[model samples]
Every structure is written in structure tokens, then in C-alpha cells.
Target: MTDMVEAPSGSGWKLLAPVRRAEGWLASVPAALPLLALRLALAVPFYKSGLTKWDGFLQLSGGAQFLFGQEFKLHVFGAQYPYPFPTAAAYGAGTAEIVLPVLLVLGLGTRFAALALLIMTAVIQITVPEGWANFHLPWAAMALTLAVYGGGALSLDRLIGLGREKM
Candidate 1:
């Protein structure tokens, strides 16, 4: 008589096959959730800073010039406006930050909002050479991530079926 070997069925390892499959399905959550959380968390600081600047636009202009004018002199590649460019830049940045952060939080026009925020961040990065070392790279990274990923699953963009529409 030939000896026969039987394969294990419903063994502990076999039982874990379904669990392993479930884990594989859930792995994407780790990557996506953190990006979504970071975007949401950043919205608060951006919105608050924008509001503060809007509340004191004049002061912000003066502050912007005082803080950024010298740096602007180095990297700015355009004809200097007669009045201070830093002030104008500051106001433009403030307005974009205010409006875009709200849109970003709502996930409406997410790509557009991310682009606006990216512009504002680029302006700040260029205008404040000293601060650039600290925040410029990180801000650029975050803005680019948002621009690419776009508000993720929890955003109104997804809820409203905007994600289904072609950009």
C-alpha cells in the first residue's frame, strides 16, 4: 500500500489567510489617512494666519516689507513696481490663503485651491530668504502633495461627486 499525505485544512495558518487578505486591503488606509490628516491640520494654521493678515492688512504690508524686502531684492526677476512689492505680495498671499484654505477644507475646487496656495507659498519662500531654510521646502512639499492628491476621501469634492468629473 502506498503511503498518502493529507493537506491541512482550517489550520491556524490557513484560517489566517482571510485575515491576511483583509490586512492587505486595509494597508492603503495608513498611507492615505496621514496625508488627509496633514492637509486638514494645515488648513487651520493657514486659515488663521490669513484671517490675522486680513484683519490688519496695512500692518501686514509694512511688516512684509520690513521682513522680506531685502530678500526680494536678491531673487525677484522682474521690474520692480514703483510702490513696495512686498506689501502687494503680502496682500495677495493673504487673500489667497484665506480663500483657498476654506476651499481646501471643503474639498471644492481642490486642485485650484492647491494651486493658489502653492503660489502663495512660493512667493513667501522666495521673499523671505532667511525663513526659506526653515519652511520653504516643507511648504512646497505639502502644497505639491495637495495639488497632486487633492483633498482625499473625506472632502466635499468626493462627497459631492466632483471627483468623478474630469478636470
Candidate 2:
């Protein structure tokens, strides 16, 4: 026997029939595409940003250093605080922006990568509070979704039997 449940007959049900059909169609769509898309979407921005942070292999760019050491500040309760150990912060951020996004795109250690990016997104929000509506919110949402959902069947996580849950 099929597990599908039929909606009761009524005007409201008639109105919702198309929606139900659409829902069914959506259900038929494979989870892999969306999961892969999510991974790529989240990876692109961070990967691009990471590219700008380095001038040479393992070398932090002057612009990145200047921004972290002098320009970027943590906003808290109407107060702005400079980042402590700014050089270390810059290096750490630069490295993570590269490494984590690569892991996310490859779906290797996907949950951990997503969680790291989510944390980075949170820190970015604190640093650039005004970007919440435009950039930070979307990044956080994507990261959170990936973190919770895990990489799907298309992922290394699944191939390696890491995140056994389907996206």
C-alpha cells in the first residue's frame, strides 16, 4: 500500500490541489542538486574573499592586514572595539576563508566546514552589523542549513558514511 494521503473533498481542497501537486513534484526532485547547489553557493563568496586575502602562497596581502589591523572593528552595544591580535586574526581569517570553503565545496567534512562558516558569518555580522539584511543574513542561513542538513548523497560525507542523514 502507498503511504500517500488524499486531501478531503471541498472547495478549499480544490483550491489547494495545485499546491499539493506542486509539493509532490517538488518532492520528486532529487535532494542532491539542491545540496550541491547549497554547498557551491556558500563556498563561492568565501572562496572569492579568500582569494583577495593572499598576495602569494601562505602570504597575507597588505590590504587584508591593513583592514584587519586598522579598519575592522567589533561592534557591541554602541561601542566599536578593535580586533585583538589583529595580525593573527587576519591570518586566521584568511586561512579559514580558503580552507573551509574548499571543504564545503568538496563536501568533505561538510558539517564541520558549514559550522565553521556559520561561526565566521556570526563574527562577520558582529563586525559589519549593517550588512545583516543584505549579505550576512543569507550567508548565515545557508551555512546553518548546510550544517543542519549535512551533505547529501552526492557528498563525500555520504560516500564515507560520515553524515548518514540525508539532506
Candidate 3:
């Protein structure tokens, strides 16, 4: 048997290879910028909201219990939740929001943080349908984008070259 190997004959493939690479690179640029902006914008509110919960953990927890409690008559989607349980959920939600935002900002554990925030956003949307119209879509979109694209160029994960390994 004779071994056969084919060599490039300087066809159109070679000519278009660079162009394809350039196009691919360009496509990534748009995605990267918006992702960075979204992360930064979302980070501030998320961090602040989380901090507020941490600052008033007791009151917030109580408030959750009160809001979700059966006695409150506040059914999210025709379902009544136990007061104290809602409170616990609120506390957990707040803590996740606060912690994940920081991690997102730092570009550390980006995928994990993004996923956590995504879940938090979903829970909030469900628990408070009224607020869903205003904040749910945007927050959910941002979290999803971050989950997909990860922390941008300015992230600690990228700076340290650890993004790929962790992600």
C-alpha cells in the first residue's frame, strides 16, 4: 500500500482563511462589549440589593415571612406560601444576589455566579409578579448573557488566564 498525502495548492481556501478568522474575531467583539456593560450595570444593583438584605437581614427575613405568609393573602400565582418560609427564601435569595454579584464583578467563578444570579432572578420574578414586568426581563436577560459569554476582558478570571479552566 502506498501512503498518499494532499498538499495545499494555494486555492481559494487559503485566500479566504484569513477573512474567516477576521470575521469570527469581529463577531466576538460585539458580544464582548455588551456583555461587559451588562455585567457592570447589573453588578451595582445586585450588590446594593444584596447589601441591603445583609444590612437588614432580620427585618427582611421577617418581611418575607409576612409577605409570603398565608395570612397575608398575597398569592404569587394563586398559591399561598408560609410566612417564615418565604422569609427564609428571601434571606437566601438576597445572600445569593449579594455574593454572586461580587463574584461576577471580580470575574471569579463567573459561570457559577451567573447561574446563581439567573436562578435568583427567576425566583424573584415568580415570588413578586408585580415587579416582574419592570425588572424581570432585563435581569434575566443579563444573567443569561453572562452565563453564556462569561466575564469579559476586564475580569479577574481573564487577567489571570483562569477563565477557560474554570468555565
TM-score of each model, in listed order: 0.62, 0.89, 0.65
lDDT of 2 at 68: 96
Best by lDDT: 2
lDDT of each: 0.65, 0.90, 0.69
Q: What is the alpha-carbon lDDT of model 3 when measured against the actual structure? A: 0.69
Candidate 1 backbone overlaps, count: 0
Q: What is the alpha-carbon lDDT of model 1 when measured against the actual structure?
A: 0.65
lDDT for position 141 in model 3: 84
Worst 10 residues of 2 by lDDT: 1-10
As for lDDT, the candidate ahead, 1 or 2, is: 2
Q: Which portions of model 3 show Cα errors greater than 4 Å?
A: 1-31, 56-77, 165-167
Better of 1 and 3 by lDDT: 3
- Model 2: per-residue Cα lDDT at residue 117: 95
Clashes of each: 0, 0, 2
Model 3: pairs clashing at backbone N, Cα or C within 3 Å: 65-83, 69-83
Model 2, 1-167: lDDT tens digits are 12368768889878976786888889888887788899999999999999999999989999999999999999998999999999999999999999998898889999899999999999999999999999999998899888888888888888888977644
